[model samples]
Target: MKKIIPYIFLISVVSCQYFEKEVPSEQELMEKQMKEINWKEVDEYPSVADCEAISDETLRKQCFFEFLASTIQQKLSVDTLSVLYPELDTIEVRVTINPDASMQFEPQFPKDTVAYDTIKIDSILRVKLVDFPKVNPAIKRGIPVKTQFVLPVIIKTEK
Candidate 1:
């Protein structure tokens, strides 16, 4: 019985050590507070010079709004979806160009970014959809919502 008593006491001491709780360090607390204080900036819309360049009044207006909407959607997608659903393999984007006009899409990722994919601009200058697996869910939801922008292409003069 005496031997068992010592063993029990030792066991209790070892178990207590294993159950010790961890306290947050001052540096960690400061970092957390800083993160909470930092505010994210709101995105800006395209400038007026962008609007004036569109030769077709109607297309210009449509394009102007569309561009702004698209930018917002892209930002949201990157911010929300990427964190929530990593399994989402890809995102698709569609572009449409008028019969008399030609257009191209330029996708830019960060400098250190490793993912590489080719964007094919349709012969008719319309993109049906683009799929980006790395996109954020917030931005993905915005994809269906479209903003119209005006196209600045001038009419051709034929003799």
Candidate 2:
């Protein structure tokens, strides 16, 4: 029994050395933490007032798009200049919704089209955006954030 006790103690001390966990270096820890941060996902999507009640994220996004398009169409339909411009083909507009619900617009038109006054387009868009329904800004880590969307506006000429 005395011999067995000394052998068990030796085994335990050796086993504990192997079981000890090695502390990660500072750089390794930082790299691991950086990998945990996700840049692609937002905690909540930007939503119009009408879409705020939706629970599903995909549906909420779809609802927001529909609401935005409908609102823009409704407001723009009243402005003849917006729909009809000389030699205007199709333009892509970048719309950014700020955390405070204000909007910034940037329009891109093809070079092949006839030159048009950008100031007029900017003013029209500004006025239309003022009438847009208030939106809940996107949330990243529980903080409201500005979100941008690129929308295509097609201009159709009468035959």
TM-score of 1: 0.22
Best by lDDT: 2
Which candidate tops TM-score? Answer: 2
Q: Give the per-residue Cα lDDT of candidate 1 at 76.
A: 39
- Candidate models: Cα lDDT each: 0.40, 0.75
Listing every candidate in turn, what is its Cα RMSD in Å to the true structure after a full C-alpha superposition?
A: 19.6, 3.0
What value does the lDDT take at residue 82 in candidate 1?
39
Q: Evaluate residue 12 in candidate 2 and report its C-alpha lDDT on the 0 to 100 scale.
A: 98
lDDT of 1 by residue, 1-159 (tens): 999999999999989978898989999998998776523321222223456567775675566556544553554343433344344334333323322232233333346744432322121112322331222111112232222233322112222
TM-score versus the correct structure, for each prediction: 0.22, 0.79
Error of 2 at 130 (Å): 1.2
lDDT of 2: 0.75
